[model samples]
Target: MNRHLDTFADSIIAGKRLSEGEAAELSATSGTDAFALFLAASRIKEHFLGTGIDLCSIINAKSGRCPENCAFCAQSAHHATDSPVYPLVDEERIVACAKEAEAAGSHCYGIVTSGTTIRKGEELDRICRAVRRIRETTSIAPSCSLGIIDQETAVTLREAGVETYHHNLETARSFFPSICTTHDYEDDVETVRVAKRAGLTVCCGGIFGLGETAAQRIELAMTLRDLDVDSIPLNFLNPIEGTRLARADLITPLECLKTIALFRLILPEKKIAVCGGRERNLRDLQSWIFFAGASGTMIGNYLTTTGRPAEDDWQMLKDLELTAGSCRE
Candidate 1:
């Protein structure tokens, strides 16, 4: 074991955040005891957030027919995976799903649409109305993941009572082109900036297991740090059949733990969540993600894939002796 690893772990244990160089070292570490790192990260999570899990759920309010050619996405028009192309869900349906998410112990319900941007007019109008209705009728915070958003749209959503805006960076700047040619990484950064400028909490994170080298993962984390994102949703790639990256191997649970632990060390006070693809990639060891400094999670189904049921996730929280509560439920 590297002596520096223990020293880095100790800094976190002592309630001191890691320096950039220290965070780089931890993210670059491989072949170490991942569980040991998880233990250290669990201490960090417990210190900052206690044993509470901020549970949220997401619905693909609008799906398929995305113009972007993101190689890992099942919803991209470039992929042959069967997906339904639908206009945004009606406001009534959006509100109803928020109610269901509340009943399932999720405090936040995300409205995700597959596209390059959520531009002006009617689509934005319907979304805003839905957000307003949810705020008035339920306790759930309406989080939006409607692709690239400008400053004005961000303000509009904020005024409509939308709380957080999720725009994932998806990969390191250098490695981004290999993943998606249709949109660049800087575009994603600007959207986060817009969201924050509008006084909305920015939930941003990248997916691992996209064939990125360890250094690229660290680069992505440092980028997130620079942006001062409020929430980080760490996703492991769940390679869907027919997508270009479908044959990509699953990221081991150990790798996932290491990433989460490093993220905890890097963003000591921000919300770090175990998001999409945890179930398939983490297998039976998903419980340890919380122990590895994940303070939150997307509890129900993901955008194009089925997630573990809400009851199962709730039971996992109980087993871990963690309290689960949110705006809705």
Candidate 2:
């Protein structure tokens, strides 16, 4: 293990945040030094967040026909992918999905849609109704990933029973232009800011393995740290068949674990939920996410993708002796 890695980890453990330079150094580490980094991150996670895992699930409330030309997205209209395309489901169906997530022991249920922006209209009304239904009937907290949002819409979602508003940066500012062109990177940042200002806990994170360098990953984390987001969902790229990133190779499991540890080191106390692409990317090393210092993870289906079964995930938690939920079930 490198001396600087230990020193930086010790600094984080002793209540000091990692500087951009130190974070870059950590991202540059590989092999055993990186494994040591994971250990140190696990310690920081246990010290700050305890061993309880915050489990969340999401339903693609609406699908496909998106105008955004994001290279990694299968739902974009510019792509020739076979991703499911449909209008937003009615409130009853949304409620049913929320209830299912709750029953599977998920602490949060997010309603995600495929679009550039989830504006105010009938779609908004239906989402509000679904949120209300979930709040009235289930213990699971309601959340949304309704694209770029204004402060007014953020407040409206809050009043509609949304506890968190998820708007992923998707990648670092420097790398974003290569990945998506329809929306500006600053728009994502502003959405998170507005969501936070409107009294919603911001769940902001980015996808990895989109041809970004390790330093770029750290850059995204720094941006998230600055945003003071409440939850961070670390999604690995899944390379849908028709997207521009379809031929992009998958990141190694070890690298993914290291990335999760880096996220823990960067945002020591924030909820780090390992979401989309875990199944293929993590493979046999999936449970290593907990060991690498993730505070939570998504369990069940994903937007345009299937995830590991809830039962398998539950058993993995049991095998690892880690409690599930935002705290405990």
Candidate 3:
């Protein structure tokens, strides 16, 4: 183990944060040094956040016909991907999905819609109703990822019992145009701000490996820290066939672990729930996420792809002796 890496880790454990240059150097670690880097992150997580793991599930409540042109998304009508396209499901269906998630030991159930935003209409009403019933019928927390929300919508969702709001910044401000252009970076920032003003916990994080540089990942983490988000869902990009990023190279499993560790070191006590692209991106090394300092992960189907069976995840957790984390507690 590199003594310098150990020293840096100690500093973080002592509440010392990395400067931008220090963050850049850590992001560049690999081989044996990388091992030490990840070890430090795991230790920090165990020390500061405890060994608790937060597991959540998301249903693609609404699919496709997205107006934005994010290069990494198959749901955009701008792309010709063979993804399912549909309006928001009925309240009954949404409630059923939430119950299924709760039954599977998920602490939170998220309703993610594929659009620039869900305008105030029948879709929004159904989503609000679904959020209410999930709370009334089950012991699970309800969250929503209905893009670019205004203060009024955030208040409405909060009134309907939505505890958390999900909106990703997707990439660093400097690199934003490369991944998406239809929406402004500030548009996302504003929504997170609005949701927070309405007393909603913001669950925000961006996708990795969309051709962003290592420094850019650090930049994204710093932004999330500044936002004081309640939870951060780190998603590795899954290059969908029809999306512009299909030609983008796959992020290696080692790099994925490194990024998770990086997020943990940067955010410290904040909830780090590793979400989409774990199966494809991490492959055989999926269990390393906990060691990399992730406090939780998403289970069941992703927005555009199938996830490993929930039983598989449960068995993995049992083998690792990691417990499922709950927002309620």
Best by lDDT: 3
lDDT of 1 by residue, 1-329 (tens): 44555666677667676766766666655665566677777877777767778999988899998999988999999999977788788888889999999889888889999999886898999999999999999888899999998889999999999999999999999999999998777889999999999999988999999899877888888889899998899999999888999999999888898999888888877788899999988999999888888998988888888998889988998888889744322
Q: How accurate is candidate 3 locally (lDDT)?
A: 0.91
User: Which tens-of-lDDT digit does each residue in 43-147 have in candidate 2?
Assistant: 888988888989998999899999999999989999998999999998889999998998899999999998988857899999998899899998888999989
Off by over 4 Å in 2: 2-4, 327-329
Predicted candidate 3 versus true structure: per-residue lDDT over 49-166, tens digit per residue: 7888888999998999999999999999999999999988889999998999999989999999999999798889889988888889999999999999899999999999999999
Worst 10 residues of 3 by lDDT: 320-329
Candidate 3 residues lying further than 4 Å off, grouped into runs, are none
Candidate 1, position 167, lDDT: 92
Deviation from native of the Cα of residue 237 in model 3, angstroms: 1.4
> How much lDDT does each candidate structure score?
0.86, 0.90, 0.91
TM-score of 3: 0.98
Better candidate number, 2 or 3, judged by TM-score: 3
